[model samples]
Each structure stands twice: as structure tokens, then as C-alpha cells.
Target: MDRGKKPTTFFANRNNKIYMDLKDIIRENTLRYLPAKSLRRCTSVCREWKLYISTPFFAHNQSNSFHDLSGFFCQSHSSQPSFISLDPIAYGVPDPSLKFLPEPVDIRCSSNGLLCCQGRTGYKAYYICNPVIQQWKKLPKPDANHGCDPALVLVFEPSLLNFVADYKLICAFQSDLDGYEFDIYSSAEGSWRTSGEICFGNRQIVPSTGVHVDGIVYWQSRSTVVAFDLTSERSTLIYSYSSGSLGKVNGKLCSASIQGSKLTIAELSNPYTNTMQMHSKTRAWSVKNVTLNDSVFAGQTDQKSVLFIGGKIVVIRLGSTLISYDTRTNDIKQLATEVDYDPRMIPYVNSLVEV
Candidate 1:
């Protein structure tokens, strides 16, 4: 054996080990940052890679890495439902481009990356879907009639025990009697059950969409704000400002009321209990008034709506035009769009959660 050949063998073994270590590091990062659809296709690569991606720890971190504002699911009476992306760079994948539904459906509400929709035609059917993954499941029909229009809210969270997702749907409708009835559907039970009823002295108007903060859902009525506790299945009323829109800003429930030229924002403090349930008693509301910019109105006489787009940004819309107000910087900017129809915008986050 030659002395020069001995040094060559030593260098070859060292380089081979370094190459194997680099391959392992790349595999770990890919599982963490890849989109859901791309990750699904990666499972076919090899058996060891498939096992690593299938773990619960990887799934939880993958979801957190992809959780952010992706786009909005917008629908109006004049046009079909469409999902418009806000940031395509963060999306990291091609648009899902899902346009058709089994039947004509109305997107009523959204929570935790899930959209709650109902059938437009004869039999009343409900659906829960993740638009990015294009996966959906049809809910079982309720026992009692939901009348012509029913108020509904959906809550969804992905399970850590298994890869399956868990969801709940709550419906509020007018009863034949004087009061209103509430029904709740549970995915764990796979059935719909009736909850307690609340009798408002006069008829109350409930909005189609509600703001879900923490575990409580809030809907505004003519005179009071209705609060529903998801954990306890109980409903209560909080006597805050009426005739205003409800939204969540910086993890607090806020209401924006419009006066002649001033916009008043009231935020509720200590609204929930220690166990994360909504308190029955009314809480204090901290109020702040912001003078309106005349340019925002633009001499429009139509009704306007307010929506909180996370953080300090609040959007006000009259028709097709949208004005966004930043609380931190006191800056105002109009949102631009390419669509022809007036989009009903809401705060949305894109995720890899599959139903």
C-alpha cells in the first residue's frame, strides 16, 4: 500500500459524512415551511420522509408557520363567491381556483380558516370548508325548521390527537312562539341539539355574521349585544352601545359607532372569566372618539360598514370604495381592487388546516 493512497481514503470518508448531514437538514426545513398541497405530494418521495412528516409535532409546527393573512372569501348578490388573495408571496403556492359548489351556496361566516356556508336552494344544507385546501364536509340537517333566514356561526380547530379537525355550528332562528330558539351542532356527537331559548320582549334582528374572540361569539342587535358562550352553551346580553358594528382589535371585543362626524370605538375589558367563558355581567367599555375625514365619505348617502382587519387597521366601506384607518399612525388609505363587484370584505387568515 502506498502512503499517498492512505490520505485519499481518509478525505473521501469525511466528505461522504458531511453530505449526508446536509441532506438531513434540508429535509427538516422543507417539512416545516412547505405548503399543505406540496407537503402532500412529498409523502410519495420516500418511506422515511413520509414518516417524519406524518408526526403530530411536525403537523402542529407546519400549521403555525403557515398561519397568516392569505386572502378573503368574498361574495355579493351580483356575483358568485370568489377568494381574493392579499399576499401571494406568503401563500407560496398556486391559487386553488375553486369556483363551483355542488349547489348554489351563500358564505355566511368564517372562523379559524374555515368558511361556513349554507345551501341557497330547497333543502337547507350547511357546509364547512378550508378554501385553500379545497376540502369540505356537508353537515347534517337540523331537526327543526330554520325558517327563511337563520343566523349561524361556525368554530373550527384542528385536532392534535389525530390529523382530523373538530368544528361546531350554532344556529339562531325565530321560534313559532314569541321568543327565539337556539340549536347547536357538534362534530364529536355527530348530531344537532337544542339549547336554551331567550325571549326578547320585542322581535330582535340578528346579523348573519358574528365576531368570534377567544371562545365567545358576539352579535349586535338593535339595543343590546348578544354574547354566546361556546364552552357552556349559554347566551347572555351585554348592554353596550347599540346600532354599531362589532369587531376584534388586539384581542379585545370592540364596537364602532358612528355619530354626525365622529366615530366612537368602545372596547370591553375583562369580558371573559378565568376559565375562558364569557361573564354574565356586563363589563366596562373604554371609549375613544376619532373625528371622521370628510374625504372618506365622499358625499355618499348610502349606509356604511366597519370591519377590523387585525392589529390597528380598521376598514370602512360604503360601496365599492374602501378606506382603511390605522390607529397607530393615524393614516388613512383606500383599498384597491381589480374586481368589478362590490366585495364584502372580512378579516381572513390562510392556513393548511384540512377538514
Candidate 2:
């Protein structure tokens, strides 16, 4: 405002160097709340802005601050990957089908910003890719070929201390020593190894039913939930329940069961330290029951149709309509219609983490 003074947009100069201005400090904190796709575009605004968004600390901050539902990557054996954006403007990938990979891939598992897809071109090798940035890494073949549909789950948690993304993939394949063994791959070490822990007995585990929470990965079998701890490298039979959708809520593992309009959300006590939880059949308490009093849920009685997309409750009803129920404000919005029902609608989180 004054000719004699510089505007507040610049810094209060000292020691022959200009420090960050008040305006930039506010913007730096604010930009962390934006999605990775938005932040990547903002990097080209200017050199200072590029430097601000390029920092590992900034990426970590943004990941920590905003992990809400972005969208879903719906895929099946019949079709390529299709993105169903819950918020089109705020969250999406550059390529929904992920054509940027070396070859067409089957979307196996997704965690945080990374996707673990098995390539169709070469030996059906596994690939870890970040669709937001179009970066991918082909993993060396595991010690065990998990057949056609392995119970594969990717584990990734953004660390405040580290910015470089690291992940692990666990394949629950059949073992000769009775039942199942985990063929694990670690990105940090860049190698695959098999764990000694064997899940004994015949368990019908589905690949689409696998989910990673905290450090443990759980898969829904025909009648029980089998868990494998990444730290302990052991597999245990955790919670035994009927066929339902397994998901996480507010950092705790929960399962969702839908019978017509009556939706039951059960919060399972996943005690990692207590081995007793594995042996004993502990019940999952129903934390909440939501009734969708509308035609959207008319006769769809599939118990395993709920998906945790961000903080919202997303339900794919009968393969025709996609319903999103707001858990916070009690707002109901139909995200999409005429959608094909692919049992596995992978919840996608757009992030800047490299492959």
C-alpha cells in the first residue's frame, strides 16, 4: 500500500536473505489439505511453489491431513478398470484403466496411493504403481506363483518421518505343509520371501476379501477371518463370523453386513498382541445400524457389498446404482447409477507417493 514499503506478500528481509512471507506460510499449510492430483498441478505454478510441494515433508503432511474418500476403481475379469469418482473435481487419476503400465493389468490390491496390479503381458508379473504420477515398478516373481487369483493384499501407511513410499505385498497361497503360507514382498528390501508361519487346515480364502489394517492383513474366509501380522510374521485365525464385507473405521477393523435396508456395522476387537483372540471365537459388536429407507436397497440382500471410501459409507447395490451415505453429517448422495456390479470395487486414494 505504501511506496516506501514492500507488500506483505514478500518476506521481512534479514541477513541479506528473504525468508518466507506470511502469505506463503498460510498457503503452505493450506495446500497440504488438497489431494495429490491437485497438488501435482499446483507445482507448475512457480519455482517457489514447486519447491514447496516437492518436499517429502509436505507430501507426508498432505497424506496425514487428508485421507478421505476420493473414488473407486471398479474392475472385473470381463472389463478393464473403470474409475467411479465420488468427487470428480477433487479426486481422480489421470488414467482410470491404468494404460500407462507396460501392459494391461488386473487391479489386485490398493493401499494409500499405490496399486498392486498383476500384469497380463509377461508371466503375469506383479506391478506396483502410483496412478496419480504414472510411475510403476515391476516386482521380481515371488518364490511361489499364487495361481490365478491369489489372496494378495498390499500394505502401505504414509509415515510422518519418511517421505519415500515403501510397501509390502502378501500372497496367501496354498502350502504343502497342510494349508496356506504367505509369500511376502518388501519394497524396502526389494525382494520376496516366504514366511514360516503356516495357516493350517483347508480355508477358502478369497483374494477380493483381503484388507490391510495397521500392520496386519486380514482376509475373509468362508466362515472365519484369518489375520497375518507383518511384524511377527505369523498367521492366526482372528474373528470367525458369517459372510460379510471386511473394512476399517476410525483406525479399527470392522465388518459391514447388509440385509435389504438394514445395514449392520460391527466393530471387531483386533487385538494384535493377544494370541487368545485368534483361538477364541470373539464376537464383533454392532457399533451402528443404518437403514436406507429407499428403493436403492429394495431387494439387494448381498451382505458383502459395503466399501469404505474415505470417511463415507459407500454401497454398490445390485450392480445398477452406487450409493454413498455420509457418516458424519447424515447426508445421502447418489454417486453413480447404471454401474456394473463388480464384487471388488477397490477404494482408491490419490497420492503423490512414488512407486
Clash counts for all predictions: 0, 1
Least lDDT summed over 10 consecutive residues: which range in candidate 2? Answer: 10-19
Compared with the true structure, what per-residue lDDT tens digits does model 1 show for residues 1-355? 4655534557878989998888688787756676555676778988878888777677666665654555556666556676554444444223333344467777777766677777877685988876766677888889878776677777765555655667788777777776666788888888998877564545475655477777887777777777878788677767666466677787888888665446788887754433344754544677889887767665667556664444566666655655667778888766644434545554555656666
Computed on alpha carbons, the lDDT of every model, listed in order, comes to 0.67, 0.76
Candidate 2 structure quality by residue, lDDT tens digits, 83-187: 888778778888999999888888988888788999877579999998887889999987686988889999888777766777888899988887988998988
Kindly report which residue pairs in candidate 2 clash with one another: 69-310
How close is every model to the real structure, measured as TM-score?
Answer: 0.75, 0.85
User: Could you give me the TM-score of model 2 versus the true structure?
Assistant: 0.85
Report the Cα lDDT for residue 123, model 1: 88
Model 1 lDDT-worst window of ten: 91-100
